[model samples]
Target: MNKKVAIIGGGIVGASAAYYLSTLPGGDQINVTLYDDGVGQATSAAAGIISPWLSKRRNQQWYQLAKDGATTLMTLARRANLSTDVYHQTGTIVTRTNEKDLHDLYVLAQERREDAPDMGEIKQLDEQQVKQRMPFLTRSQPGIFISGGARVDGAALVEKLLAQAQQVNLIVKRERVKLDDHGKVITSMGPQRFDQVIIAAGPWINELLKPMGINVDVRPQKGQLLELSIPDFPNQENMPVMMPEGERDIIPFGQGKLIVGATHDDEGQFDLSITPEATQDLMTSAQAFVDSLSADNIIRSKVGTRAYTSDFAPFFGRLQSHPHLLVASGLGASGLTTGPLIGRLLAGTLIYGGTPDWSNYEKPLSTYLS
Candidate 1:
């Protein structure tokens, strides 16, 4: 019997899951339909960093999850037929403001190196080396450079995933969805019955699930970004991603556009407004690293609402309340990094009918269901 699968939310997670299910063997038996409203999604506005080694997280489980997320980027790029430039292997320089912070980062790089040798040539960079590598950078602090660090154009990635999924006969719908009784889904187009429903919606998960009396601990985390045009910056092609001193990061998107972001604000709503305070804060910190950036360099600014969870871990698995309903969300900032792996794991679970090892990171939404 064919299993009709409804994927609610057309962001990275949902799109990737639909792509995997449409392409994988035995997936032909699973009819997949992906619905998306394209409003307030995180993937489009993500900084798209894939270097998990830069993170200070000590939890081995979390590290492994992030590692897998980083590892799967190449495979996803290949599947999407995207070039390396599009999936960007520009590498990343993880630095700090003070000696203490640099020492902490050094220790973390050392500790995680053995487990993630795929990160490629983890080396400590001195001030001169940092400046030479990142010509736009003005900070003189030493940092750790992961040669394998990469970034992706999130909007492009989503477009490719949706396009590829459609090539394999996956239905794509642009509409909001709601759950009806008897485990069926109702979209603006119409109501449809599916054997399985995966909610990979970003911050809007609750909007669809609430009417059905289902709730998860996922909420919207707004991150604002500033795009600066530096057409004259030297070494534009080879400039490494700069993470200097604080939470602010600079990702050069080539063609003289640099993405400086971001601010994590938990305002508890779908607010995409870019505030003057956030713009000033991001611009001030960004200029501290890239000496060339000025107020005039500012081209544009945008905001994305990420799906944040109480535990900082994404939930992915079947809900106890609705056996047919599955969830893959709450990825926070790592959604673009771990999206492919999430899709692969969820598709495998639905098709093969086993937990399969990686599902350990996929907590059941029922745990936080209200």
Candidate 2:
């Protein structure tokens, strides 16, 4: 018998899960329908950074998840025939303002390189080398360059996934879904019964599960970002992503275009308005690294709300209270890097029912329910 599966949410996590579920082995036997209300989608707002080595977090679980996520993105890029402009392996330059900070970054880089050999050519760049490689950077601070670091276009990736999913007979509906107690999915068109439902809503998962008396510890993390265009900057496309050991990053988007951003604010609201304070802060931080982006060069600012968990880890697996419901969310800032893997993990569990090794991922809400 064919199992009818309904996926709530259309962000990266949900989209990736839907794509994998509709194409994985034995997936053809499953009928999939994806419901997206098109509200609070963090995937499109994501910075799409894929540099796991730059993170100083030494937790094995987090590291493994990020590593697998990066690997999965590469595999998907190739499999999906995504253009190079959309996904760039442009590498990353991790910099620090002071000598002590630079030294600390070097030590962490050494440790990370030794632990993950596949990171590929983790080396320190002198001030001159940094300038030569990334001329847009104004400061002469020492930086660490990782060859494998890359960036992605989150919005483009989602579109590709949706197209592929539809190609494989997965139904895409832009409707808000409500789940009744009996596992009936309520949509605008009508109520539909599904054998299973997966909640991949980024920050709105809590609202969807509230009727079921389930509250996953997900908070809205507002990240305000800036998009800039540095016109006539020589060889800007080849310049790598620059990080200043802060909450901000400068990502190059080819053709002298740059994305400087992300002010982390936890106001717990869906307000997409950019605060003047955040814009100034981001611009000030970005200017310290890249001199060209003056006040006048500012293109525009945008906002994205990420699903942040209490433990700062993603939730994956079936909810024990509701056996037919599975969830994957709370990816925080690492969603672009880890969302794909989370989807694959959930899809694998659904396709093959057995004791699976989920040690590397986050604990599901079921762990707390019991």
Candidate 3:
């Protein structure tokens, strides 16, 4: 008999798992069912920045995962025939107000590149060079350009992934599901049993686990971003993603579309309403780089809840106590960068028989869950 697999959540991680497990070798032997409530999914609301090479974050494991994810995701995007509008390798322009700090980053990229050539070519750019690449940018900060950086259309990618996975024994549920007990998964439609279950449900994973007396160290953070349409801007599609030394980043998509903002509001709780203050804050930040940017160009605002751990590091694996259950969360804001690769790792563990060495990828899965 074929094995039955149930996946909770339809975001990047879950969708990627379904895509890989069903489309990869030996995929026809296992059936996949995906459940998604569609309540404030972070991936859809994300700006989709995939430039992990220039990040100053010191977590080596995260860096390693994101670095590899960059390569894997872009390769998969090409192989999957995702259009340039869906995902594009536009590279990235990292800016710093201080020249010394900018130069230090350049040196670091070069050193890291020795180990990760996928980080792509590194080049320092003067203010004029930066202006030429991103004409809308008015900031005088120097920049370091990493040629391998890319951008993604998170919502579109998930749609394509699920559509492809459905070609070979994949069922998608558009409603919320529940875990009634430690090993039993109960759904609204009816009671079901599966050979394996994977929970990639963002911050809400805790809610599912709580019924079984398990509360993983996870919390929900609300994120807000804005979309702008600048029709007259030249080379919007060819422009590199603008990543300043702060929370705000500017991503250029095809045809006059620019994605901006994204605040990590811990106090926002689960509220999905757009905040006027957040819009003002984001516009102000964007104005710092583009003085010509006007609120009139605003298209829409995106709000979603992101999952984070106490230590801010992501962990994924099967629990020792429940061998049939696998869980992954705590991706925070970098979900767009690390999610798909993590999903592949989970599916590979089961599809190929036995756990792969994940020592360098993360700490013990026990660290995130008890």
Candidate 3 lDDT over 55-98, as tens digits, reads 77888888899888888898889778998777888889888878
Among the numbered candidates, top lDDT falls to 3
Candidate numbers sorted by lDDT from highest down: 3, 2, 1
Candidate 2 global lDDT: 0.79
Model 2, span 67-92: residue lDDT tens: 87888887878877888666777888
What tens-digit string does per-residue lDDT give for candidate 1 at 1-370? Answer: 7788888887788878888898889988877888877888888777677788867655555667778878877777766688655687888888866777777787878787887876887888889898888776666568889888887778788887888778775898887778765557887767787888888887787777777777678878888889888865765766788777765878887678788887888873578888988898898888687676778998888788998778787767776667777777788888888788887788878888854554346544555567
Q: What TM-score does candidate 1 reach? A: 0.93
- For residue 312, model 1's alpha carbon misses the true position, in angstroms, by 1.9
Q: What is the TM-score of each candidate against the true structure?
A: 0.93, 0.93, 0.97
Instruction: List residue ranges in candidate 2 displaced over 4 A.
Output: 367-370
User: Each prediction's Cα RMSD?
Assistant: 2.1, 2.0, 1.3
Q: Which model, 1 or 3, shows the larger lDDT?
A: 3
